[model samples]
Target chain A: MTYCLGIQTHQGLVMASDSRTNAGMDQVNVCRKMHLYIHEGERVFIILASGGLSITQSVTTLLRRDFDQGRGLASAPTFYDAARVVGEQIRRVGEMDREALKRDKISFNINVLLGGQIAGEKPHLYLIYPQGNPIQATEDSPYLQIGESKYGRPILDRGVRYRLTTLEEAVKFALISLDSTMRSNVTVGPPIDVVVYQNNDLRVRRYRRFTSKDPDLQRIQFQWEHSLRKAVLELPDVDFDEGAEQVI
Target chain B: MTYCLGIQTHQGLVMASDSRTNAGMDQVNVCRKMHLYIHEGERVFIILASGGLSITQSVTTLLRRDFDQGRGLASAPTFYDAARVVGEQIRRVGEMDREALKRDKISFNINVLLGGQIAGEKPHLYLIYPQGNPIQATEDSPYLQIGESKYGRPILDRGVRYRLTTLEEAVKFALISLDSTMRSNVTVGPPIDVVVYQNNDLRVRRYRRFTSKDPDLQRIQFQWEHSLRKAVLELPDVDFDEGAEQVI
Candidate 1:
């Protein structure tokens, strides 16, 4: 289980993911889910993976191998082309592992949020399905999330708008969404990785990892709870007016 | 597909449920999920049901039949007995229909959140599983929700506390939770039925229905969205300080 999110804003893009991996309750481990590929001033691609740990790891390992052999994504001309190469690599990994996993009653599940920019392309975001197909985020639906997504969706539905948000605001909302997901779901634990890509820069601009003890994360949670309680109080209270006809 | 919740608070209990039922997209219809049986000063029992429509309807209809025949729930000594009867009734329905449904590849799946009070007894709440087993809500976890629950859960995790909340506050939180669930999920829809049982009253004290066209329902959702956006703005913005050290 995991939680990963990607958002495209007017000013840039933001991606966030938790690091916990669990095959079962007794076998929990921490592994980085956010992988970065950067070519300095030329291009950058950030992949946030979720689902089977072994499958995602295999896909990432093969991707790295592709870069090592200079045969795939490294030379793709645009973000769209890079997404295709990533999709192809995911299928390659699935082809190699799916039959073995099926024999064990295990699934070859994997989902990836691939986003970043090429030198001449706009920053783009794509959600690649386990079947190796992908869908790009558009202005109408400017964000995508994978794994344990519902617990955090209400906040995004109410707070985010691609045309209205600045890069900084997107980061704030992404962190808050991740915070809500982490609190409600045990599978998505700490050591959250966040990256911000400034539009037109064609490179990664900011990245940080927050652990359980991070003061800033704690403060965010505290302030959110405090203001939420206060805000709830400001909402109109129910009056219980319907019982006049049948009061006991 | 449905969403229903019951909350226990210091002042009383609040239950809210959406009223959508669908066999498929084209078959969507309005059907209340909240059921009430009030015996004036003697007792009151509320049931919020979710899952397979046929199964829930059968269980509910059978319970009504039992009460009509004076063979169950209505003559039970306490809320616990009534809950047991409800569970027994669910299992009875499954016994009668499970095999016939299995022929069509249909599952005998359902869940129920039951809560209320009997005279001389404290308020009680139970979650009855499809297999007819039941678990009561305790002080440590004072709420129970069935079906499409996750989208609305984070707010409850951050807001509701049974030890301190007034009945009015519980109603507000339940409405907010329902609103969030409805926004994120299409399977759960309006006309919502809400009931409030004030502790020691031994009967329901409030009841109301809100449809999609209901002005009050819209007002609640509008104010919630407004307050939530304002709350997000009040939180401190994320500073992109990590990038100076790791720029690519």
Candidate 2:
């Protein structure tokens, strides 16, 4: 299991992914789910992958092989074209592995959030489904998440917007979403990778990995707990039936 | 779809359920998912159901049939016995419907969160699975949720504790959780039913339905959005590559 999120805002774009992977409770491992393809100032594409690790890794490896041969990412003229190339790569990998996986009773599955800006186009973000089709984020839905998405979706629904005018806020909200998932699910863990891009900026502005003990994260966790408790306590009580015996 | 949550705390228990049912996006309807059985000064048992509506309704009907025929709710010897009776009722319903559901390629699925106090037993909470087996809440895990539970689980993870000492706080947290789900998923909607039980109190302390127009709920929605935006804005920005052109 995994959790990955990507947001495209007026200010720029923010991408975050956790590094935990587990086959079962005792078979956990750490693997980077976020992959980057950069052409210096010309373009930078980030892909946050989730679902079966085998399928995603196969897709990533096939894309890398194409790039290594100068067939796709290195040569695609636009972000949209690059996305198509990535999609085709995923399809190619699926064609090669799906039958074998079916023989083992495993479903061929993978989903990805692909986002970045090219030299001449606006920065865009998309959620690529396991079937290779994709949906781009719009003003009404400025963020896309994959794998273990539900636990973190509510915060994004209430907080994210296309006019997220500040990169700081984007990062914070992304972390808070991750924090919520981490607390509730054992499959998602820390050492989170975050990358921020400023609108029109062709280069990656901020890229960092946050560990569990990071002071800022610790503070956010504590503050969230404290505030939640306070909020719960502040609500007015409802009237109870008079003859009700106290259960506690 | 439905969302129902139940929490057992030192002070008592809190149970809440949404009133939405849908066969698809266009076939949505309102239906209460909570059932309360209270015998003044003697016992009070709340059942919050979720999943396939038919299965849940059938299960509830079977339980009601037994109670009407003198099987134990108001006259239950103990809370454990009451729970067993509920479980037995579920099994009977499953026996009557499981094969037919399977014939239609539908899942024979429904879950219930049962909690409240009986005359001779302590306040207890149980999460009954589709198979009619149930797990009781303990000090380590004091809450159980059935159907569309993921969207609201994060808040509980961050706020609920066995030491949580007040029923009011529990009720508030439960509402907050429900509100989060309602915002993110259209299938879970307004007019939520909530019941708060005080330990040793044989009757319900508070019971009400919350709608989108409710003043208190509106206040919570506003405050939550404000606080969330504020929290996001306070997060530190990620350091990006200096020469990168801003994407916006």
Candidate 3:
């Protein structure tokens, strides 16, 4: 299983993904799920994928090769077109493999988070489904997440306000979300990769990857844990004297 | 859908469950998923259920009707036997319904959390499966949860240490966990039912139910949200000046 998410804050976009993949408990492996395509000042696209490795890998491979022969991510006219380009590749993979794999009862699955900047447009985020359909993140939700999303969703729901959060704060929330996920689930683990792109920067900046032992990751996780326990402890103590009959 | 859990703390055990149940989006309704049977001074058991309402409702109905014909939950000799009784009822329900449901492509599904005290035995918690098997929560984990468990699980992982926490603290954690689940998933909602059982009490005591509009429920949810955001605000800031190349 995989856990990856993208936050489209007003200041910019922040993306995070875990590095664990498995066919079963006995066959576990680490694979980088964050991919970046940069045409420098022209355009940039980040794809964070989760699902069957075969399907995601095939779609990304097709996306990487598109630059030489046809319209590629870097050449797409806008972020929307680039997202569609990704959706189309997912469809291409599903067409080629879904039926053959169905013969063995394996379902073709791939979910992609596509976010980045194009020179003339504001940065945007889209979640592409296994069915090759795409949905853009709106200001109301202000974030897109795929794979193992629920465990981390409440914090995003409560803390991420696109218009009020800064690029740096957005990055912080992304890591915190990932941290909550990793604590509750073993299917997701670090070496987590994060990317922060300021709205008009038009270039990738503030990229960092942390292994489980990384100091910054450790400090952030420890601080968050302490704060969480303190928060729980600080809650008003239950009044057993109320006799538990008080419905209010 | 539902989210119900039992925590075996040093002081006693804490049980909580949301009240929403649905066969489909259009078929949603409010149902009490928590059941209590008391032999008063001899034995007591609380059953929190999730999954097919037909299966769970059937199991509870049989257990409730047992006093007139067979041995009832109040008659179980130990907490362990009470758990087996719940599991056996589940298997009995499966025998009666599984094949008929299969004709309609619906599989028998229900998960139950049983927690209470039986005379001389220490308080205990058990999770019963559709296959009539049961697992006891141990000193190590000290908690059991069913359906929509993940989003609320991290808090239990962090705040609950059975040997270390007071029953009041455990109760606080359970409500906070339910709050997290309700915020992230629409399948689970209030009015939630909670019960606290102290070891060797051998009585059905301390039961409370909270509707969405319940003032105490609102206070807990609001306090949790405020503390959570404050905790996030108190975390150390990220230094983007470290540049994009850090990998550790």
Candidate 4:
């Protein structure tokens, strides 16, 4: 299991993912889920993946080969085209692995988030489904999540706004969202990878990996807990008014 | 879809449920998911259910009939026995309808939370699965949730401590949890039903139904949202330290 999310704010994009993967409880392992394809100032595509490691790795490897050869995402004219390139690669991997997985009764499950900027286009985010189709995040709904998404979603629903949220604030939202998920779910664990892209920077500049004991991460966890508890206490008390219908 | 949870605190038990039911997007309605069986001052069983509406309703109806006849929950010896009574009804309902539902390619999905106290027993909460097995909540994990549960779980994880939380705080936590789910998930909505049972009271004395526009419910929602935003703002800013490993 994994938890990966991408946030597209007015100033830029934030992509984050947990590194833990488990085929089963006994086979837990840590593997990087965030992949970056950067052409310096020309273009950049950050891909975060969740699902069967083999399928996602195969898809990424294929995309990398083409990207290294100056094809695929390396040459795509826009973020949408780059999403299509990733989708096509996913389809290619499906053609190679889906039948065998089906024979074993393993569902063909993969969800990918493609978020980046082409030289001439706006930074964007897309969630590519197992079927190789893509859905882009919009200003009204500026975030996309995959794997163990619900635990962290309420905070995002309350805190993030595409136009008003800054890149820095988006990073905070992403980390807090990831923190909420990690606290509630065991399958998603550290080290966490976070990348922040300033809109139009075209090059990846800010990235951080927070291991399990990272002091900053611990502080965030501790402080968020404190704040939430305090906030919960300050909220209006439950009005167990006598007028509501009584079941018994 | 539904969201019902039972929280056992030091002072008592709090059971809450949302009232939304849907066969699909086009067929959505409000239906009560919380049922009560009270032999006042003796034994009180608050059952919150989620799953196939027909199946749960049937099980509850059967339980109600027997409770009225002084044969089922009314005759059970302890809270565990009461849980078993509920589970037996679930299995009976499965026997009656599972095959027909399976023939139509529908899954026999039902999850129930049986919570309350009998005169001789301590307050207890049990989660009865679709297979009619029951798992009781313990001091270490004082809450059980059914249906669309994840979105509302983090707050419960953070706030509810069986030996420490008061009944009032538990009610606040439960309401906040439900509000979080309602905000993040369309399938779980109001009017919400909440029943608070004081440990020795046996009978449920505090019950409230918060319809969509209920002023108190709206205030809780509004204040909680405000508090959360303020809490997020007060959280320590993310430290995108330059020393952390950079992927690009």
The top-ranked prediction according to DockQ is: 4
The TM-score leader among the candidates is 4
TM-score of 1: 0.97
Question: How would you encode candidate 3's per-residue C-alpha lDDT over A1-109 as one tens digit per residue?
Answer: 8999999988889989999999898888889899887766778788999999999999888898885455678578888888888988998888899899999999887
Model 1: per-residue lDDT, tens digit, B51-160? Answer: 88888999888887777786687899978888888889988998899999999998888999998898998998899999888999888888999999999999889888
- Residue pairs in steric clash, candidate 4? none
Of the candidates shown, which would achieve the greatest lDDT relative to the real structure? 4
TM-score of only chain B in every candidate structure: 0.95, 0.92, 0.95, 0.97
Arranged by lDDT, best first: 4, 1, 3, 2
The CAPRI class of candidate 2 is acceptable
Tens digits of per-residue lDDT for model 2, B1-248 = 88999999998999999999998789999888888777767778899888888888888877776676767565568777777777777788889988998999999888888999877678999888888777899988888988888999998887889885567778778888999999888899989888888888887767777778988788877876776666566545444444323221
True contacts kept of 4: 0.61
What is the DockQ of the complex in model 3?
A: 0.49
Error of 1 at A88 (Å): 0.8
DockQ of each: 0.58, 0.46, 0.49, 0.61
Number of the candidate with higher DockQ, 1 or 4: 4
C-alpha TM-score for every candidate: 0.97, 0.94, 0.95, 0.98
Clashes of each: 0, 31, 0, 0
C-alpha positional error of residue B123 in candidate 2 after TM-score superposition, expressed in Å:
0.7
Per-candidate interface C-alpha RMSD?
3.2, 5.1, 3.7, 2.4
